[model samples]
Target: MCISNPNSISDQTDLVAMKARLWALLRKEEHEWLQKSRLKWFKEGDINMKFFHLTASSRAKRNQISKLKEIPVKRLSVGSRRLLERLFSEEEVWNMSCRLCLIEDSSFNNSFISLIPKIDEAVSPEDYRPLSLVGSLNKIVSRVMARRMASCLKEVVGENQFAFIVGKQIVDCVLIANEVIDDLSKKKKKL
Candidate 1:
């Protein structure tokens, strides 16, 4: 049946009637599919709670950073130093304070704090990653330059090597590669 009641946009009864009819058709199709095949929809069929839980866990584990290369935050503040005084030895405090000092130094231009997900069951120290943040001013300037240069870039960049070029897709490279392979196959037969 045609699924339109133009007046239903303003009329509640007509809208409800239309929705009931649509639901009836969908349920009818679902019953037919259930009868026709053994396969059931994932959410509506055989529930594998343990398998889904494990798959979700594996995906989360794979995305974690094994180690960090940068040592940007060196030290703890006096308050932090006091707090960590018992937890860390004297030597540890010195190392932490130096990094904290570096983080505070405005003279060290264009550095910002980076925070990312870390692996902990609950919110704790082990649950976050640190990265070097870039300056906002530099980001704005780079974006402006990219926008202005896009038109000029289209003229100079080759028909291939379309990675960063505007209005081109990597799919184009795949298509061109297929054509080259086909030509090579035909040429080999001729020779």
Candidate 2:
């Protein structure tokens, strides 16, 4: 009817309004269909076959452990009686340290490298911090060595070395340097 009356502006406006209403109703119906599809029918089987397949394949890939390297297990020569000894002697500590250094067994030195993200969404290599998860035996040995060397640490290391010392901090050195700089720059220096 609007096509027949081409010059009627009122008719053209009414036609446009009707078309808009139809389009709105069509969109509403499509949204309802999408919601209904997601609720009940989607549980039985997905309407979007491509999307379902993609999700399934991605999940499978994520779950699958690919190219896992074989780690060979080796038995230690040390007896269980000596290994489980509660008392620590100088000889035992020395022996353990020497054995750890010379041992070809990967189990003693094996470590898992875990990447911890520095930011919420890590993009590059620099965004992650690599943390090594070492074996319990290795940690025990390291702790024992550290404890043994802690007494001699102050004697071996100088007073100027503020890092890795139990009683000292690097911030102390920074504060001292700042004070020295301030004193040196003064008109009447007392440094």
The digit string of per-residue lDDT tens for model 1 on 18-132 reads: 8999999999999998876655436533497776678678998999888989854334345543443344345644454454444444644476776677764537656777787
lDDT tens digits, residues 35-151, model 2? 997786577457777778888899999999988888753433245334434466777566666655644465765778999999999999999999999874676577665665564
TM-score of each: 0.29, 0.36
Task: Give candidate 2's whole-model lDDT.
Answer: 0.74
Give the residue spans of candidate 2 off by over 4 A. 1-111, 118-129, 188-191
Mark the regions of model 1 whose C-alpha exceeds 4 Å error after superposition.
1-110, 115-130, 182-191
**RMSD after Cα superposition, model 1:** 19.1
Candidate 1's TM-score reads 0.29
Least well predicted 10-residue stretch by lDDT in candidate 1: 80-89
| Whole-model lDDT values for every prediction | 0.63, 0.74
RMSD of each: 19.1, 20.1
lDDT of 1 at 63: 96
